[model samples]
Target: MRRRPQKPRPTGASQYRINHQIRIPQIRVIGPEGDQLGIMSPDEARDIAVEAGLDLVEVAPTAKPPVCRIMDYGKFRYEQSKKVSSARSARVEIKTLRMRPKTDTHDMETITRKARSFLEKGDKVRFVMRLRGREQAHISLWITKLNAMVETLNDIATVIQTPRIEGRMITATIEPNNSSSQSSSSSSSSAPSTTTSSSSS
Candidate 1:
C-alpha cells in the first residue's frame, strides 16, 4: 500500500485552537496582560475567559500542559487576517547571503556587516551556507558557527527561524529587533543627566 500523503500543515485562521477546540484536560493559563495564571482545567480556563468577557485561546499547544490565554478571539482573528494582508503589501525585503562551510573570519565579518545593514533597514536576512564533499560530515560544527553568527546580530535582530541543516545547506532567518529598539529609546530617555552643584557658605 502506498503511504498516504501527509496533510499540508494547517495555516491561516483555521490553525487557531480556541475555546472548545482546546480539548486538553488541563493547561497553563495566562492573563491578557501576559502574566502567568498558572495551570488549570480547560473548563476552568474557559470560565475565567467567560468572567473576563474574553476568549480562551491555546497560544502554545506544544508546551507542557499547553498554554492558553484569555484574549478577544474576534480581535485575534481580525489581526491574524490583517497580518497576512499587510505582510503582502508591506514590501518586506529579504536578502539571502550564501556561503560555504568553514567560512573564513574575513568572510564572516563581511557577512555580519551585510546582515546588520539588512536588519537595520527592517529587512530580513537569510543565511545559507552550502556544504560540499566532506564539509557536510560535521554538521554540528557548522550549526555552531551559524548560531554564533546569529548571536553577533542579536542586539539589533531577532531570529524568526533558527538555523537548520537542509540537505547540504544550513539556513536561518532574522529580522529587525523592534523590541530592542524600543527598549533602547526608553533607556536613553531615562538616562541620568542632572548634575548636583554644591554651594560654599
Candidate 2:
C-alpha cells in the first residue's frame, strides 16, 4: 500500500511570503533604503535582493500588484517585535481603590494619595465604596463622601463617571485633568531655579 504525502506545517514566518515563496509574477518593490524600485517581476526582484544580500519580503499582499521590500528579514522581524512591545508598554491601565462609608481620615488620605499617583502616571482610577448591613440604607451619605474625596484630587484629576449606586456599592471613575496637566507641564518647563550668586571682593 502507498502512503499519503504529509502537508507542510504552518510557521510563524508563514504570515510573510519571502523570496521564491512570492508566486506573483509582478510586484511593486521597495529597495533596502526604502526607495521605490517600480513594478518588476518577482524573479527580477529576488535577483536584486540576492545581490544586496537581503530577502525580498511581501509586506502588503492586499495591494493591486502587492508590495515587496528588500531588507534583512531577521532585522525587519526584530523591529516589528519591538514596535509591538512598545505599544503594549504604552497602554494605559485602570486601577481600582475600594473603601467603605465609615473609612477614617487616615485611610481616606492613603487612598487619595494612591489614586493621585495613578492619575499622575496617566492611568484611570475607579473608586468603589461597598455598603454592608444597614449601611445600604444611607447611599446618599456615601455619595457625599465619595464626591468630597474626588474634590481633593480635583487639582490633578477630573471625574469621568459620577458616583452611581450599583447594588451595595457606589462606583466612580476619574482621569487625569488635561488643563491642569498642560499648565503644570508648561510651568515646569518655563520656570527657572533661584540661586544666590556670591560676590568676589
* RMSD after CA superposition, every candidate: 20.3, 15.6
lDDT of 2 by residue, 40-70 (tens): 9999998888887788888999998999998
* lDDT (Cα, tens digit) per residue for candidate 1, span 1-201: 222212223566568687777888899999988998999998998887877778888888889989888888777777988987755434555678777776788888888898898777666788888888998888999999989999999889988789998888888987788733443444454431221111111
TM-score for candidate 1: 0.45
Tell me, by TM-score, which candidate is best. Answer: 2
Error of 1 at 60 (Å): 51
How far residue 13's Cα lies from its native spot in candidate 2, in Å, is 13
Poorly placed runs, candidate 2 (over 4 Å): 1-30, 33-86, 179-201
lDDT minimum window of 10 residues, candidate 1 = 192-201
- Cα displacement (angstroms), candidate 1, residue 162, comes to 0.8
Clashing residue pairs found in predicted model 1: none
Report the Cα lDDT for candidate 1. 0.76
| TM-score per model over all chains | 0.45, 0.52
What is the lDDT for 177 in model 2?
Answer: 83
